[model samples]
Target: MSLSFASSPFSVVCSEVSFAWPDGTTVLDGLDAAFGTGRTGLIGVNGSGKSTLLALIAGELSPASGTVGVAGEIGYLPQNLPLGTARTVSDLLGISATRSALHAIERGEATEENFTAVGEDWDVEERARAELDRLGLDGLGLDRTVATLSGGEAVMVGLAAQLLARPDVLLLDEPTNNLDLDARRRLYEAVSSWPGVLIVVSHDRELLDLVDEIADLREGGVRSFGGNLSAYEELLAVEREAAERAVRVAGSDMRRQKRELEEAHVKLARRVRYGDKMYEQKREPKVIMQERKRQAQVSAGKHRLMHEDRLSDARERLSEAEEAVRADAEIRVRLPATEVPAGRTVLTVNGLPAQQPASLEELIVRGPERIALTGPNGSGKTTFLRSLLGEGPEGLQVKIGVEGVRYLPQRLDVLDDRLSVVDNVRAFAPSASVNTVRAGLARFLFRGRRAEQPAGTLSGGERFRAVLAALMLAEPAPQLLMLDEPTNNLDMASARRLSEALEAYQGALIVVSHDVPFLRTIGITRWLHLDRDTGLTEIEPM
Candidate 1:
């Protein structure tokens, strides 16, 4: 099933690749693609097998059929780094053994085992720290535990570990998921300077813009574009325009063919009637008239088949044309019940975290004001949200005036995996009937059987939507909605859909995110920054 595609010096290739989940859900089928040396941005909608393909290439997953070939050793960083709180920076960098062996050698206990572990890399620690510093993680020391690092810091450390290996191939899945503005800049520089074969799966537009080319995986195939994300988008826009026009033309042709078929039927009927009349009128010999009628019927049958075939062909063309036009739907839901009055007090935080950085002591949020919480990695933005919700540490006083306040964490663990999407939402909105819940889920694009699917079987974007449905459809409706890193791991279309869904919400919002572009799209009215040194402070929108 392998098909050769035109490529230049491909460093990675998938030949006749086919893969399916254990549940018999096919992801990729006979997918053939090749990635040339240099940075390639692998772009796709959620659940299009982009991550699965990376896994196959990185040797983390083996294909059920076909083969994946790589030019050399690989360094892979998955979308969600499997991190433990007790793991130290040295452990994360994968140099703990080497560092330990080097220390032992320095202590004059230079055994053969220690030398074997150390190998020829005596500067492993220095190189590891250099990579960390390059990614703007200098403040995080080697002995610091993962528990002390933020989500973004952990990601940076994982990347640092990969770069330290200097593998011939590098694979990064959503590398910029939790990185702040400055950290993202540092990553962009690293990506720009990468010389070897590099492939990244990310929804970050800025990061994609730095790639040498774009590889779009869709419909079980890979399409290579010669330029970056902007160029690919522009080209795609043009192609879609042409495809839409083709659809219109095909539609017209199909309609015309259908009309011609109807007209041919009418003409055949008229001919049959005329032949019967001629036979009845005795215009010729009886035998001759009968023979003429038989010939007329045969001719009519042929004519009918010809017109039918034409109509069918035209319909097939129309279908093919329509398939080329993408209709990525947006989430369109209205929640008037979540609206709040202008003078209503939503929340009042009487105190802050009892840590150093005594910057702000009190805060108040009123009405449906949308606030953006931004900060550097490890600056306690997420912790601040938890403290305000009374879910985390002690000595942090907070008073919530709103009765209906909901929080959507970055992990999206609110839903019960075993339950259907409808049931999950019903759990939050217990009073709402099944029919009523279904009618509401339709607005989120979970129509019919999709609403009945278990939460575990959903794709990344679908799970996000399902979680949002649960939060918004909760009993009494959430008057204050808090989301932490809501856009992490979300495809571009999904992110846009999130904004579209939020357009109908009339509730107060507190969002902790590092994505400034996303914050702008969601209409943040106030911008706040949290720092360990300065505590919490208000800043103007960029």
Candidate 2:
């Protein structure tokens, strides 16, 4: 597959770009890639430098070597929105000055500076509002502070700001990270209808399915596939099949070459034996016999060397073919210890929040029910989980019946940063020996030395595995597992692995997330919606 799109007038190009962290960790080295005027989905495993490449293209970070050339203006929305507590929606939209100037002109204070600030954006407020509405943020007024908005609202507002800029190139990093189902749908619509160069770094499959191309970054380079993610996956499936076949063929060839080399050695030995017999029989003069023996040895050496070279070439080809097969390890662990009986009362809670439905005032969970807690940002979904775990605010009253409930918060703050992965797991599974903890962690993909790496030094995906290992491998085994937005920072493969791990968890689960697809994958048996307007209520799965 090609590593770049077809060049165009408005293409963005990186020529031999190299970037490294302050710690001298190399990300992109001598990477040459181009993105033309179309929607491109940039995907890679965690730590493959997709976000770093986006930053370089957006000019948020400078390349240590080489240059980035863009033919038009660029608007970038990073993975995290750095919204200040005091910043307002207008400030986030990047139209604070224009809105203020327009208001000043409306009040008959049309100063020259105000006119310059407004410029041709006299309808900036209307446009901003339109962009907000397009992204399902219309209800959030422009005057409201960003700190009061939910996490999804802030992300949508940031994206709205970028859209309002009307730049030629739009760059979005994990744009659907915290967005709910409706918000994601809106964002997907926007992505599908985008007219200019759109480069989005996301693990959301639905969002990636709308792209014009897939740019897979691995080993410090990008490989461009001609279609969306689904098509790209299909192509990968075919390639892997072909690669596996090639490996089998190469293995056979290698074995055949080895056998041929052995046969040639045997044949050469037989010729030597025959020559020895001839010499012993005095079939030729002594000098002529010696010369003939030397000639025979030289010919035998040439034959052996040719066979050896063939065997070596076959081995090399086999090695190369083996390299073509991908080996992305997955989390596959059994959790029979977490199982709860059908008649068991895993959890029971009393006293719902104010204005909540009276029917939900006293809730009970029996056996191994999987409940999906979903709501818009700031709808108290996380609060509800915390309150159920008896970690909420002082004024709220909550009662829990479960004793061994484990909560995996959205931030994944369960691990000590200074501790090693094995140590972190052992912290929870105290009764487990170091070797036992290491054995458990290997199931979570932190095998051997990886389990010794400090939590602070781990990458996003690695940190998640460490946290999961610590939680699931705890002593006594949790019968009720609660997770809040667990897949927010995960890549697609990691998210799938999380689902796989959760599938093996035989317990009552309460997961607070906006990821409906992921919720379905883990076999959520019940769905609950917590909303400021509707309180907490059960609903059908989407």
Candidate 3:
């Protein structure tokens, strides 16, 4: 049956929406949501159907048994963009056809087909160019090929296409995943100034902070919370505190009920003994004794039943209290073996040659210094990391003070997909027994059968944890860990868990990430920005 939230003043609506993957993993089940004017930030754990719901609203996917309603034209930008190299900027902007028709007419070939194509969109190119300029693609030509654009630029272009369309409703899924600081700011500006119904699905704290409201998709439904990310977090904290208090109170009640039940049993046994003694003493007449015994049995049954029912109710209450409490897991227990001495040089970088206009030079990392590498896209962040680690098949020349260096690239392709997570870690640490690997995996939230599952079958968060376990549990023990965009595809929960795991890393760290809030949480001792002219230089926190 079709459904609509009566209080919703939204342009986009989903009514009793249900969807499932080909593998039979149910995502949205009879979900109802509405997005009105202004910015709505859709936040949820990974695989909670946020993307699918957006897709359904965009008409990319059909609901199995429900209706999705959009008031006007819709625009959707998915997490993974279409990266076709053959397409030009005009084509990507979705105005290539109209622009061609207009150009043909300009050349005096005024065909009926051209006029039909142009229709009422004579100013489409101008509008597209204006949107591009607004989104920080000022000098980028319309004729430029899509293949030449960086990841950030591509995202901006995609967004510009949507703006050019001027759709009444817009959907963006993980729009800022691979974006750098500059591109993110541009996108944030666009979001802030949006005039129509816009729904953005992202885990970026900064981006979410700009939304007018937060729509949390959890456990197959939408929960609307007024205000931004910080506000939602504040409200959640208060609710959780209250829930935790309830749990404590319920536990006490449960213990009291249990004690009372035991006391009732003891009192009943004592009464029974007294009654039996009286009967054995033959103090009462035969008829009276029989009547008394019968009454005692009935009273005992009633008392036992009453106590049992009270205990059962207490247990049910305790279970409900526990369920109300959040159980977000934490990563733990990095060995002291991974620790780097304060005075000992863990890494000495003489110079890093970049393909850009500038070059990176000298640094002496002598302790557990947490350094954050930040830059705009295509500024040689990944190139510099590969140079330092001597990765790639070419094996670039590099020097290091320690042999314990480990690099976690953005793609996380370090695992053997065919092997189980346990085997992957075991491959890294040959000397460690199966039991040791299992124990380490447990710390990363991979327990029992999960550890035994093939790496390819794991979800995004699970795969991240597995890769992390292997890196930390390696043979030499990474004293100098280098991570490149570690939080790229992770949801908030996974990202939080990752931060918790990194909290225990005693080794020196040099991670490349655009997540400013996350960098702050990892206790960054240094911040370096890659510039086209200045190269890699130390900078104060943003």
Candidate 4:
């Protein structure tokens, strides 16, 4: 089952691969490709077919046409993890002898002698522990229930479990979405040294730059380019410019043809009038008739050529240019703001504990201040947010001011899946009319009929925008905004837009995100580090 030791360098191959959903939506069309032993970043907008392609390559979904050939074992880490309430990390790993024995017995391949030989002296438990440690989950008890783990901790554990398989092809979907700076660095380091092929679906530009190539999924197909992130961006820019130039040229040519055709018709009309006058006078009759006929034929020929030949290419060029411009347009997000009293404390924590039975000490925040909460995964980023939100009460006395606070949970809990985007925004601010809600949603790029679509049908980025729209609609807008992993599913342009919006906000901002550059861009005035060693929180001016 371990394909890493195989002789083949190329781990995955796809030929004329095409896939469609049950509803007949074409997700991929004629995607012919081969990937070998190197890290390749997969970049695309939401619903651009990145996730679907990853699933197809991982054998989780079959292609509707052609074939997907896997030369080696594949390990896939799904975007959404399902960790049952009763399962512990150790239980999930199948490290215990009892579970291993059960698996063997179920296979009908284990005898009493083999079972006894394995016994209670299983190395799987130790190996699991070692892997967890390597993932920076050291000292965390294996028997600790998964339900109690924070979101970041759970993600790290899942990643550790997959990495332990040592697969020949590793397919990761937004692997660093919820991780902090240190954890992202660790992940990057791990992938950099991985011997086999890595196909990663991520919106992280820094992570994409680390890859050997970037595969852009767009318009139901994939385009592979051998370059880093910057190079790929430059190529896209150049292509867009060329498309624009073609469109301009086509427009000019169409205009010239129209003028020439009009001139030809005018000349033909004059000649016919002169011929009719000469014929009426019974002077030069045959010559006038022939001249009129020739003029009519010439005008007709010019009109036919203009309609039949020149127009089609012109229209095609215009369409291509429009598509290119659309592709280049950055995602737009507009965050509403309100005036708030300056210099008020929004959150204050003294002796806070991020982990169960452990303590985090001295975390504090003031009003109208931008702060970045960062640390390694499982080092209490989300836990710290929860503690501030009054979700956890252990070794800390947390105090939140009476000011209006808005918290955007990491998983987009603000979104109502059953309602339309407009309805969701209206729910947050009922006094605002439906038209007002629609306008606000439009600011976030959900325009016209798109605002009427169900929230469940929207892609990840759209869903995030919907949630943000709801937040913006709230009256007496929140003076304190706490966002936990806000940029997880957002594309690069959207992330930058969100950062810009945050920077422009007049209210206090407390952001917990894995994107280091984003955090830096938002102008974090302070830094909060949650230390896992001593279960303490430290804050310093940036």
Predicted structure with the largest lDDT when compared to the true one: 1
Model 1 ranges off by over 4 Å: 1-8, 329-336, 353-359, 415-463
Candidate 1, position 485, lDDT: 91
Clashing pairs in 4: 352-360, 353-360
Q: What lDDT would each prediction earn against the true structure?
A: 0.86, 0.83, 0.81, 0.75
TM-score of 3: 0.84
lDDT of 4 by residue, 152-198 (tens): 67777777877767887899988887776666777788878778889
Q: Candidate 3: deviation at residue 495, Å?
A: 2.8
119, model 4: CA deviation in Å?
10
Question: Could you arrange the candidates by lDDT from highest to lowest?
Answer: 1, 2, 3, 4
Candidate 3, superposed: residue stretches over 4 Å from native: 1-8, 100-111, 329-337, 341-360, 363-367, 389-397, 411-477
Task: lDDT for model 3, please.
Answer: 0.81
lDDT for position 510 in model 4: 85
In candidate 2, position 153 carries an lDDT of 83
TM-score of 1: 0.91
Query: Where is the poorest 10-residue window by lDDT in model 3?
Result: 390-399
Off by over 4 Å in 2: 1-10, 101-111, 281-283, 329-337, 341-344, 353-359, 393-396, 400-404, 411-478
Clashes of 2: 0
Q: lDDT tens string, model 2, 444-496?
A: 77776667777765655567777877887887678888988888767777788
